[model samples]
Target: MNQAVGVVLLSHSEELASGAAELVAQIGAVNVPVAVAGGDAKGGLGTSYHRIQEALEAADRGVGLVVPPDLGSAVLMTRTVLEDHPHHDAVIVDAPFVEGAIAAAVAAAGGADLATVLASAEKARSVRKF
Candidate 1:
């Protein structure tokens, strides 16, 4: 069976990451794995390297992993995890957090490949609100 691409949402606020995961679940009826790593163990407004690592490990299902970070530190932490853990198929997308998560989830739900899922997240950069 083909596993759907996994998604990891990183944010400084636990609410933001969890909310985005909920939104992604609501947007599609697919069984893609959606994980959230937000804030530190103390539940403060900052990225947690440990939390991000845990999320990545939990979300990865041998298919692939896509991460959308909410802030600069979140991105940095994600990068550090990727480098240290060395999940070659995993990618940290440079796109709007919420939008990218939504897009990536939809694509993953459709059984899109890792590259396609990453592209879907990156495509969110072009979305314009008028």
Candidate 2:
């Protein structure tokens, strides 16, 4: 069986996660799991790490962790989680906030590899009309 490739979005609010989830859902790839880790400060990174851990474990093959732009402390929080759980099979990707989620969804549906997914994301970002 093909292992599942999941997406994890770390944001300042649950709404950001939900928006990403909605985009992925719209793309119609139900096989890959999509999760969101928001506002880690409230419950501490431990809570967020646990949440991310479960998502990563379920992913089996690997996961792409997305971060928003200008997210100062959240980056630290996520890094701590990554360091504490090196055994977890996942890769961290620095994704542009808007394009990242859309790219993730499109890639997941297209069954593209992580590098391809990331490339696609960059392309999408670069091709802005504005």
Candidate 3:
């Protein structure tokens, strides 16, 4: 089986990021590399570039990474980091934060490729909970 893709969640709140990662684990994605990049350097309610960079570096296992950002600024910070590190096999998938992270983890645990894993996360954007 192919190596599992990784997930990096960017959130303004550390608890939110950690909780989502915990959910991924609780759902049996123990093998998936799930990293959380939340809060700012001061640990306040803001995204941190350093945290995002560290998370991407730590989560990547030579396969790829699907990053889901919680807020608009989180996306901007992640984009800047991605631009600086073009060599990293990662992509910013515009998807629902928690839903996308869970989907990505499940797909990756099932041995899906980078593209397929990314697709799984992106598909969460259309999920209807009604």
Candidate 4:
């Protein structure tokens, strides 16, 4: 496993991604790469999809998790990205936004297996509210 796992936090809002980045930074000195795809407000999937692809490509060899603000968009993007990357080891999760991003960053930094990290994140979201 790589010593450092890159994380891409996909949010419509830069501030949300920034907040997640700040939280992840607090957890440890991990190189969690955050890319705010579309603006905070609800935008078309196309806008975020292209940016997400760009960010994912940038985080090569690193696991990725999508942290969208809303459920519909989150679900849609997760399905699209995962279906497109069926064989990828990147941890694409649809858990709560900030907490999921933080968990992913910690798991990535710890070199935790993508499956384990994703499962942990999914379970950990029990405490997260939206």
Model 4 misplacement above 4 A: 1-3, 29-35, 38-47, 62-70, 81-87, 128-130
lDDT of 2 at 97: 61
For model 1, give the RMSD to the true fold.
Answer: 1.1
A best-first ranking of the candidates according to their TM-score comes to 3, 1, 2, 4
Q: Please, what is the whole-model Cα lDDT of each candidate in the order they appear?
A: 0.90, 0.59, 0.91, 0.60
* Pairs clashing within candidate 2: none
Specify the poorest-scoring 10-residue window by lDDT in model 2: 61-70
Residues 1-130 of candidate 3 have per-residue lDDT tens digits of: 5667989988999999999999999999998998999899899999888999999988988999999999888989998988987636799989999999999999999999999999999999999999
Off by over 4 Å in 1: none
Best by the lDDT measure: 3
Q: TM-score for all predictions? A: 0.95, 0.73, 0.95, 0.69
TM-score of 1: 0.95
lDDT of 1 by residue, 4-69 (tens): 899999999999999998899888725998888998879999988889988988889999999999
RMSD of 3: 1.1
lDDT by residue (87-130, candidate 2, tens digit) is 35455555576577677657766777666666665566566657
Error of 2 at 28 (Å): 1.6
Q: For every candidate structure, what is the RMSD over all alpha carbons to the true structure, in angstroms?
A: 1.1, 3.5, 1.1, 4.1
Q: How many residue pairs clash in each candidate?
A: 0, 0, 0, 1
